[model samples]
Target: MIIKKTKTILATTMTSAMLLPSAVLGKEDGRRVLEEVIVTAQKRAQSLQEIPMSVSAISGDMATDAAIVDTTDLVQYTPNVKFTAANPAYSSTSIRGFGTPPLAQNLEPSVGLVIDGVSYGRSTFTNDAVFDLERLEVLRGPQGTLFGKNTVAGVLNFTTAAPSFDLSGYINVAEESLDGKRYEAALGFPIIDDVLAARISWRKRDKSFGLYNTTRNNEEEQFKDESMRLKLDWFPFEGGEINLLAFKSDFESVGNGMQHSHITPSGFQVYREADPQTEDDEFNNTRATNAPTFTSRFSEAIALKMSVDTGDNWVFRNASLTAIASRAQVDTPYLLDSDFGPVNALSLETDGPDRYKQEQFELRYTADSDVLFGWGDSVDWVIGMFVGESHATVTQFARQNLTGLAQLAPLIAEGRGVPNAGAAEVAALNALIGAVPNGEQDVFAVNYVRVFAESYALFAQADWHLSSSLTTSLGIRLGKETKDGANGSFANTPVPALVAGQENFDNEGSKKEYEVSPKLAVSWSPSDELTVFGNIAKGFKSGGYSG
Candidate 1:
């Protein structure tokens, strides 16, 4: 009996307004006291309750308890956030129902990701491991006024824990039943009594816990990951500090356990008549494939961050200046079966090494509760300038087995009113196409893409406290982006007639775009427990080339 059941599943992304940690409420001598949750959603540190926008702050301890290991896990905890991934290179994140589709190599991410005050130019880096973090903050709605371009949806901000003056360390290990194991460790110590400190964290994970592949007689969806981060802090002067951060990660996966969820009657008939490896296809944890498939990626990054306080001596009182410079790169190579079946139909692989590199620099000034343009001590202001450049190279090649296509040659012959066009003719045709029916791989097509991009931006924000219970904020950003792209496609088959009508082409183009984003917000706090806030913000995304 085939039992078909249908049910609606509503996934509600809960807002954290009322879901703040219970630790926020405390009782002392029959009096209610609230502990503040601090956040830097606006590029400045402030109480979460005082921010005039939607934000969710999750501490590292809470993340550990929730088993949030990577950016994908964050969707379950943050409201209006969604994540999907076929692989690390094809992960997509959405906020407020806005997100780029997976494998959209031509478009930038709708939601931006920033770590330790450094913005990652590409979304592919979102799959890196999350460890030893101080806090994770999700800022909802358009954040382009503060985060610059590519934040039309929202932003995910990660802050790693700073090295402590006191020596401290911790280790965590876990194991599962399906040959899964994870190890994480962190250490922090003072290199010099009061001048320097260092902290380091490392993690390793191996998992083989997915569907079984009957064709290969092995487990599918197996992966291994390793990551490490190191931080150093140096106090150069009374109110100046310098920080160095380095990070590295390696990840590899074997199989994805992909299978068709639905099929039409005619399609099923053709699939079965040709070479159907499995008969069941209804949410089954089994896949049938006879191809070598694997994906691997290695990433490295280094950043230098410096901050200095003016100490009430400059034009702005109680102001601080911060600067950051960062460099990052990701190298990924992968191969996969395009036809997910037992038949050696087709495969896709990288023609050579694939790489993406980014360099960024930013300088900002922040004044806390200081007078701005003679506005008294109720206005806090921030201004920053950012410059970035990136380069990406992606090359793809397709290999095909003519036997899979030859399986349908007889049907085509019959349809054309040709009587008794036997298998011998099909074999000859395959040979003429520079392929064989004996499951030999032949180059079918190759596509190469190269992109270089540069962007410069200036952003500023000011919050004015009209009264003890009312505040207004205004922010704006002006940016310009330039991109140069080159693309080449070639049909590499020997016989033009057998390979259809595909032509080789080479294209190159350059473009420049300018954007202006502005934001205005107002917040009213009637009491410590009651607050109302609203904002109107403009967003922008730069243009790009299609792969």
Candidate 2:
């Protein structure tokens, strides 16, 4: 009965955490329903209700107080959009199940991220703090015709709120059981006239620990973590904007928990512990022994955009962007619980962990009317040149059987002036590199986010009106890509190798094909509030290994 109840509680907790990102709506015309959404998949705004794509758009207002912490939150609500929270610091995510498990930073994202018009790379960049987010637009289908590389899978675009001409701000605070807290605040005041304005925001999540009941003997039998972000916005002109945002965070959770610390057969309750005396004083004995995991991350980005109307039929837009980011860690991790405690605790050492950075610039000209061209009464076109450069580094560490319980048990026992230590217990405490393995890795890559060659890209597109109710469009993009990586293959790893050899492993491999995906779409509106549209697109994921 106790085991059943525990399982039920865990399921319930997970369900609630997954759904907290959603909300209930007020009674609407005698019907209760989810909110309608708007999206900008093609680099232009459009009502999601009118688009045929299966997209999820979490608006500014909805995103603010929701449980959706970062890009990973989308997995709970979207169908076929799955992700594995491989670790608190890293995750593998996909749309339409298109992404292969990620292996290297150079292996391009199956799904891309765009923030304030700048592309965000894969790697630690995935952990960039969320803040001052005005809106998060997730385009679920292929967006190849509009967005360049990686759009073959889809895109996640984040637009920060622009500075308000008026002075206003708000703060949010929340607390949860098992000891948890989160505080976020943003304030925007004019730094200049309406033509120029500035805004800033900050967010933080202090260290909060979780309790691990009597289980696999562990010197450190608890976990806690922290994260934060800061953002700045500057609008120097009515039609042009500049944004500078920076974020940093560190997370250290001692005992990241095991699947089963004390699972007994059938109806029995077993007694297993790492020496209750030591764990009971975990917090009080904070000279910092047995903190199994340590992680840290830092990221910053700058973007500038300028848009000016040349005439009634034409507009010109120019943008420049730069970003730098990294994630590093050394973890004493355990694997595969044997229904009692960790079956294998491995010591992992990592350094200069992973880094990805880029600088980009773009120039695009768009027109809404046919007045500039003599071919038709209604037509539009977008031709642009984009230049981008990036350099990155990735490192993976070696793992060795490691545990701190026996070592700490003796210490706590000795501290209490125990009469003597058992011969078996004394022999259980030692290894090279402190029961850990050391590893080294280095890789450099230059990839383009838009408009040109290796580590860069350039492209153009166009549209035409066949008649008042029917329209046609065509787009073409040409680019280059590079990916390079070397890691201890999952095949060479004892655990994964055994799992792969015995279990049905379905993870896909890398896609080396240079992609060329095009799209075709149509829209017909018969009523003021309704439109019917359909589209067909070819999309692909850059495949690779994952460990």
Q: Pick by TM-score: which candidate is best? A: 1
C-alpha TM-scores of all predictions: 0.86, 0.65
The digit string of per-residue lDDT tens for model 2 on 304-422 reads 55555455532422322222222222221222121222222333434344555566666666656542355545656666665555554444443433243333334434546665643
Query: Residue 484 deviation, candidate 2, in Å?
Result: 5.2
How would you encode candidate 1's per-residue C-alpha lDDT over 121-233 as one tens digit per residue?
77777755378877888888778888988888889888888899999988999886668898989999999989999999998989985777767777767899999999999
lDDT of 2: 0.47
Kindly report which residue stretches of model 2 are placed more than 4 angstroms away from their true locations once superposed. 1-38, 46-52, 65-67, 70-80, 102-106, 123-129, 212-241, 249-252, 259-291, 312-345, 371-377, 399-453, 483-515, 540-547
Cα RMSDs, all models: 7.0, 11.7
